[model samples]
Target: MSFTVLMYHEFRKRGDIDATSPSTISVEQQYQDALPKVLFSYIDDFKEQMMYLKTEGYHTLTLQEIKDFYEKGTQFPEKSVLLTIDDAFQSVYQYAYPILKELQFHAVSFVVLGWLSNEREYFDPSISKVMSKQELEEMLDVVELGNHTTHLHKRYPDGTSEMQATSLQELKKDLAECGEYVTYPDVFAYPFGIYAPKDIERLAETGIKYAFTTVPGVNTASTSVLELHRDTVTLGCTLENFKTIVEKGASK
Candidate 1:
């Protein structure tokens, strides 16, 4: 059976930004400029999308379920979808976690270990603060952590990701380092959805079993676990658009 995977990043809540201080004013300005960007989704819109999934009988697949689908040739319902949030943003813990918890939906949060802040803040748009380890721990009931890498979640001046620019050995080391902070290290979403064919061939050496990309499509038992596709849900994704995305690649 085929199933779709959805990707998300930072979330924003209206009226939640208190632009009182100079830092906050700058934060508010940055947020306003980023509103139309693909990576930022309004929290209310995100909630509506999750609600749609629940009402439409979409089952949020877990890590083990994905492993079975890849390794054991298992089949799951067509309505099954995997929800993933990248970057481990504090906004995810702030805005997305509550909605997922309330809906009893499970999601995977891919984190860059090097970027996690030691301190937690209620809101900080300027830094777009990463969640602290404490915040991540508290969401264990509804969120599973995945490795996005340790310090390689960046792009070079030439537009290649650090993942693409570095050698496989270095990449392996980074992945292992990130594993120390997370419960699951076998799954990864490519930094900037970047990788080379040789990189994929050697990913097994790093112990990554399943890897996701920005490429949009659905996955089936026959699909390669290392090259999984995901539909990125973004700022302007309407409810109708969401339905079309989730329904587009279902098995007949």
Candidate 2:
């Protein structure tokens, strides 16, 4: 059996980003879209998507299951689905949480540990607040929290990503600092879906078993655990396209 891992960035009460919204800035923000307010799934659309999953016989699975299958040839659960929300935006707690709880569905979140510790903005000031430690603790029953590096989720002045540019030593240090939050059998989702070949080797050395990318596809035993792909649901995604994206995948 195979599975699909999905990536979500933020949640919005309104169904669409208005021209005046902070996230819909006139100036282009390519890097940040990869981080925080890059793409937003409104509460309504999210609800519809989850409802479809619930009624359509789709069930959630953990990244560990995919890792076990790829590394040990364990059989994946039938009709497995994995939902991952990147950056741990507060809206996940606010808008996405209740609906998921109501449906009794689980999701994995890749949180930036550094964003949680300091008083800082991840992107648009109005929408980038991250969840607190207490909030994270409270949601543990349904949310599988994973490490998304400590401080290297940011972008450099030359448009290079911190994850792509940081030294191995620095990356290790950041991962150690983030260890306070990450639990066992750690899984990582790349910042902006970006990674290099050495990044895979580095992840193995770091004891990270699963790392995900934003590439569109479902996971099979042959899928590279270090470079697993996921589909991002944008606000423009129609319900029909959403279903197609999940059942198969977005055709490249």
Candidate 3:
């Protein structure tokens, strides 16, 4: 069966959405010149999106169901979606978790295990911060953890990812280290939506069944699970545009 995978990163309150400084300017931009188009979404918008899914009878797929869809060729609901929040940001635990738990919707948070703190850090609404291990644990009810990488969420001076610059062995070690915290050992999201062909080819050796990219499209049975597509949901997206993106590429 086919489904849309919605990718999210940072979250902020609707009041924080300043017309002058958009939500698109994330903390990552200080280090990197370019960031993903879908970086952050308004917390209210996020809530509205989740409510829409609930009211519209959208089925949120579990990680196991997603694996079965590719491995066993199993069928899933036509209006199915997989919610993935990257970076395991504290905002997700503070905001998204409550909305999701209230709706009983399932989601996956791809975490950079090395970045996860042992205790809650100082809150700065201007910047998205990584969640503490305790906060992450509290989110287990509605969020399944996935691997983003251990400490490879960053890039080198030349913009080459640590994942890309390192040897395959190093990459495996990083993934394995992150896997220790991930709820699903077989699922990963590429850091900064960047990956080489070799990452896909060798990831299966590390027990990863699927690796999601930042590419936008609806994923079908014919799609490669290794480089599955995900539509980035950003603050710039209108609710109408969101509807279109979610339903885009589905078979009529």
Candidate 4:
């Protein structure tokens, strides 16, 4: 059976319409309109989603578990799915963590090591709120922390790979240190869901077994671990959309 991996960002209660900037928007407008309402998703809403999935007999798997199941034919629960959160937003730790714990679901978090370490302070003031090292470490017991590079620049305006290789190299070193500090396996999640074919090869060299993308689709037995696809759950996605994505994934 195929497995669908759901990718999520901030789990806010209220929707933020202007949170993200478009490529065509001017820098000034980007600054002015970028700050959107932090939509708060009630804890109950989260529980309801999980309950619905469980009722439909969907099983959740961690990244490592997915690899093991495929490569080793390891026994996994029926109707399995994988849950992942990107960018290490504080709301993920604050709002999503408890609900996940209540549902007894395992999740993977992709964090930017530089943000957690406070090594670089320049960030979009609109979205500067990220989880710190201590906060992240505290939740390591429940969620798997993985690398999302130290600096998460998607690409240069010219579409050139900016700091991509260097960032991954530094991230490897930093994650090794973090593993010593937290004792978790070193995994990576590509930032902005953007990666070159070469980047995938480079990641494999770093011993990374799995990496996620923003691509919307289900994964099959033949899915490449380095280029794993994901279905993004955004503010605009309704419960129906979620179900449709899952159903379509199952069909694939």
Candidate 5:
């Protein structure tokens, strides 16, 4: 059967930025207030969502399982699914990790290398605090970490250039440095879910086997390693919406 991979970011409580909003400013505010309590609320919802998936006969798969099924022609259980989180938000450690451990589920995390040693607020201005090195190390014990990029770029008015090739290379170098700290898997998540065909080729050259995009779709046997689409789980997605995406499937 075809598989659906769900991509998530911060799971905050009442105050954290809602992933569903189109307006970046409002979302920024929400991200700033992402406290442990707020993060846990969404973790609760995520658990409930997983339970729903189980009832629907969906089997959660790791990225490697999906790869083996498609590339090596391995057999997968029915209703296979994969879970991934992009941008190493503190909430993943504070909230999501415990939930995954409880359910015995596995997930992949794409981390920004530059953000590792610095304070959280330095990387994503929306965050008030950052996860410390010790905290990140602890997280590594539970989840698979991948490259997100080094300096997460901002819009022109906000700071520097938009995501260009030069910026992409810089990000690549940042990821390489991050690899020194953590032995990330051969996977990547395009920052801001933004990428061009050239970017995909560039990533491939970096020894990345799988690069995930926020292109809002499902994966079939024919899907390519580059331009792999993901169904983003944001604030606007209700449990019903999540179900429809998983059941109906996604495409490029």
Candidate 6:
């Protein structure tokens, strides 16, 4: 069987949802899909999953480590799982980062530079605040940072994919900005989990060694290096569901 690579998004503590916060208010108003139930995760659930991995004897691997196994025949420890989070949510520092450090596991965050802010980059009052520079510097102890593009996470009104919207120039430029901002490995987790075949060519031109997608499956040596799949952990995921994701993926 192949090893797993888990994907996660924003996280919120079970007891700490401030109903009156601008970020909360903004989602409560404009974006129906922004409900906390689906968009953010409970901190307790994250802890329990990590605990399961520990007690069950899973080895946490970074994307690079996994890549080595796939591309160069390097061997990883048994029950290897690569953990990744996208969107650079500030909640990661408060929730996932501490738990990962405490558990002595490693994770990677694919940061969308557009999401950073003094408070946050989006919303009227900027609600969904991403990690600050100081906090990110500290979080490096537990997490690696990768590119998630600068501003391609958002969708156009016509609903065309951002990477496919232009003549490949804008796509390269967006990735360039990400390279300039997010420093570390030359990995990329596609924004919006959407891409075209041409996008693969574009990625190579920009020094991207690996890319992640929203697809579900355990990655083996046969899996494509640029379009590797990941198991998504969401707010609704129970331990059983999480286990299935780690084992069988979202669909059988």
The candidate scoring highest on lDDT is: 1
| Pairs of colliding residues, candidate 2 | 33-38
Candidate 1 local lDDT, 189-239, one digit each (tens) = 998888878778878788999999989998887788889999988676799
- Give the whole-model CA lDDT for all candidates, comma-separated: 0.80, 0.73, 0.80, 0.63, 0.63, 0.72
Please provide, for model 5 over 173-221, each residue's C-alpha lDDT reduced to its tens digit, 9 standing for 90 to 100: 7557656654454677776666667777777766777878778777777
Model 3 CA RMSD to the hidden true structure, in angstroms: 3.0
Q: Give a tens-digit lDDT track for model 3, residues 86-153.
A: 98777888788999999999999998887787777765666656778898988898889998888677
What's each prediction's TM-score?
0.88, 0.85, 0.90, 0.77, 0.76, 0.83
lDDT per residue (tens digit) for residues 27-98 in model 4: 211122121232323344566677778788777777667768667977666577778876666667777888
lDDT of 2 by residue, 77-193 (tens): 466688888877777877888898899998988877766633322334354567666666667778888878887886666756788787878887887777667663368888777
Which ten-residue region of model 5 has the weakest summed lDDT? 23-32
Q: Identify the runs in model 5 with alpha carbons over 4 angstroms from their true place.
A: 15-41, 55-57, 118-129, 152-163, 167-172, 182-185, 250-252
List candidate 2 segments past 4 Å from native.
19-38, 117-125, 249-252
Weakest 10 consecutive residues of candidate 2 by summed lDDT: 24-33
Query: Which regions in candidate 6 have their CA more than 4 angstroms from the true location?
Result: 15-36, 118-127, 248-252
Residue pairs with clashing backbones, model 4: 12-39, 12-40, 12-41, 13-39, 13-40, 13-41, 14-39, 14-40, 15-39
Task: Give stretches of model 3 more than 4 Å off.
Answer: 17-38, 249-252
Among the numbered candidates, top TM-score falls to: 3
Q: How many steric clashes between backbone atoms does each model show?
A: 0, 1, 0, 9, 10, 0
By lDDT, the better pick of 4 and 6 is 6
Provide the lDDT at 211 for model 6: 91
lDDT of 6 at 231: 72
Per-model C-alpha RMSD: 4.7, 4.6, 3.0, 5.5, 5.6, 4.8
**How high a TM-score does candidate 2 get?**
0.85
Ranking by TM-score: 3, 1, 2, 6, 4, 5
